[model samples]
Target: MPLDRRSLLLGSPFLLSGCVTSPATQRPSQAAISRPDMVEADYASIYAAVDGEPFPVPAIDLQEIEPEFLRRAVGYRTAERPGTVVVDPGERYAYLVGEGGRAIRYGIGVGKEEGFNFRGAATIARKAQWPRWTPTPDMIRREPQRYGRYAGGLAGGAGNPLGPRALYLYRDGRDTLYRLHGTVEPWTIGTMVSSGCIRLLNQDIMDLYRRVPVGSRVVVLGSGGGTAV
Candidate 1:
């Protein structure tokens, strides 16, 4: 069968073989060899399909995801206070600052180009569930054939690129147009492939949505620079 978005997202067994190299040619990374603190059953439950929303969210196939990219708690030492969101595009990780030198780290897919990524402090002034997505004017100009048709906007749903939730970023009381949202292409997590927004797995973004609220601070680090943007 041809690989559709859903098929690729679900990590169909037949598709999996072609997605990665054979064990004969390459060895698994240490991160992949060592499992997270959570067991198989725990991961299954954590990433299970979510209901009770405007639309159903399909479960993520862990096999399609990198082990390091899976959501997990880690010791993070940062001056930022709890509830702050620190996005490290260089590492492709978003850290939700927590108390006691710890954080809930979620792997993220970022802008493919450094120039396209947002680098600065902003506030989560608004949020939406299954939010509408409209390509920016620049996006339309750059790729008319790809984005011009959606200039008006695309309604939120399972098929939408902005998957399940979106945390809108604002600076100086104005919308920055940079968002932290979910993606239908869960396999893209941990890679730099988005236009500009940071994308999380549908399940992971929902978890973050429940944890964060409007008015939260968001700091996106400069590409390859540890300095706060």
Candidate 2:
């Protein structure tokens, strides 16, 4: 008997070893790991896949996200106070909206203008590791070149831009037509760059995802929207 490729993918969350590689290419080193049908991913491999290789001249250390980094984080917010995230596009900072008039801030990458921009309130409905991608029909219809190829859907693993994890957002108990997902493009951390979906570095998004869970609260101050994450 032979283990199918799908089985290898849909296996356990702990399947990956503690090696955070990008989710774009499967290096030979990855095949060495074992599988229990499907297991929990160590998350390291996913980083390797989507993350660009370190260059000869490192752009920026950016290894550790310090308080200064928070100052650079972009998202929507009204005032600084702990509660839920309230993304304010006008300011480009996703304020964790802290308590006692403070917020754990994080820079964010927003969508481009027009079709790429969307405003609404939602919650972190669900999450996944190396989540498969099935572009919405609207996305395909709007830009077939970018999505027609994957109409059937994209499987989890290296090459999927969603990186290590995904924080699915919902509104009115339905997918709010957006997501706060991880990306390999780390430099885009604090800018508008997606189709209304919030993008974060694999490391940062992973960090945020860990802190929040399904049903957690999220308030997108952009265009006045709020919900539970």
Candidate 3:
């Protein structure tokens, strides 16, 4: 993913650590918005080619930025710590466990391989916006039919598959074959998608990327799951 200088910050107060700040309602000077498909040329296209006709994004029924979903604990317990991200692929939920047993959880899309999905612990090593997407060689090899279009490289923007933002996950100072990034095909959210990367709706990711900071710890679990550094 080509993460450049793009920026995002969710509005409203961050409720944490017994301290209540004002709602983080302030938008950045440059709010990123997805481009339309019907526009003309010369806009750094970054979309994957469709084998058939393109389908409109499906209507996702879930809580969005406003009126955040009131989640019920899945009868799950933990050592009970905050400031950590735990991803449970079986539940398709990423819980940002917060103070007082509260968590800001969101639905996520995971990899297809059972145990090969990212798990363990890591941090937000880096992040970018409208990031240039370079499909890993393995991804190309796995699905040449789908990825051959970018045998070379693809710029960022409309056709770009990385959507709007990309948060790179790293462990042991090495690149994990995983990423938290925006999805152009919003319908893919809450489904088994991606060769390995974790995906979110463009709008949702845009909202998340803005709230999280670099070096935030993340723990992934599922399939042949092994936790990251």
Candidate 4:
């Protein structure tokens, strides 16, 4: 049986530690309100692809996801300026700080174990649509049987693991090799299952990619609650 929203929210440690309740009367910003698909969308409407999107993003079944993982407006009290993207891996949530005291929150899948320990500030140096995927040398060495086939690279497509979009992370002038990208398996949202990549639902990522520019700041907090950079 598929995991329901209530079951996952009640059972998942991330949700317990991560979710903060906001007053019902706080309204979303103009930008948030404009996205009816995100602000007030049902599962079916939320899952539908936006017109003229460069890549294919298949509609997803909302029942397959925990409700908390769905994109929504939240009262986020953060010092970070608006347009900054802060990822709390422990909470399995990504916050796009907005004007006022609110944020556009999106559910995400994070890396396992130490992969969650990645702490620091980086800039989104590049963005891609239907980006190609390549396994790192360490990834291939660790699991050659699983990754060797993609030793060269995998073309972007509906079946590509990177899904429809990718935001490359960089620090100083170097590529951190960490990415904020979409996933083919939306069911994996709110879980620890990636190789240090931050995973978002295809639809959610498309929205984020459009709003987040190449020079946007990305702060990934540490497990110890210390800010990275």
lDDT of each: 0.71, 0.50, 0.51, 0.69
Order the candidate numbers by lDDT, best to worst: 1, 4, 3, 2
lDDT of 2 by residue, 186-207 (tens): 6656665555666666655655
For model 1, the stretches where C-alpha displacement exceeds 4 angstroms are 1-41, 142-146, 223-229
Candidate 4 has an lDDT of 0.69
Q: Model 1 over residues 137-228: C-alpha lDDT tens digits?
A: 65456557755666777777876767788999999998887888888788888986765788898877887887788999999988553332
In candidate 3, which residue ranges exceed 4 Å CA deviation? 1-77, 141-149, 223-229
Per-model TM against the reference: 0.79, 0.60, 0.61, 0.78
- TM match of model 3 to true structure: 0.61
Model 3, residue 201: distance off in Å is: 1.5
lDDT of 4 at 198: 84
Lowest summed lDDT across 10 adjacent residues in model 3 is found at 15-24
What ordering of candidates by TM-score runs from best to worst? Answer: 1, 4, 3, 2
lDDT of 4 by residue, 9-51 (tens): 2321221111100001222244554552346545466666545
Model 2 regions lying over 4 Å from their true place: 1-83, 142-146, 223-229
- Candidate whose TM-score is highest: 1
Local lDDT at 36 for model 4: 26
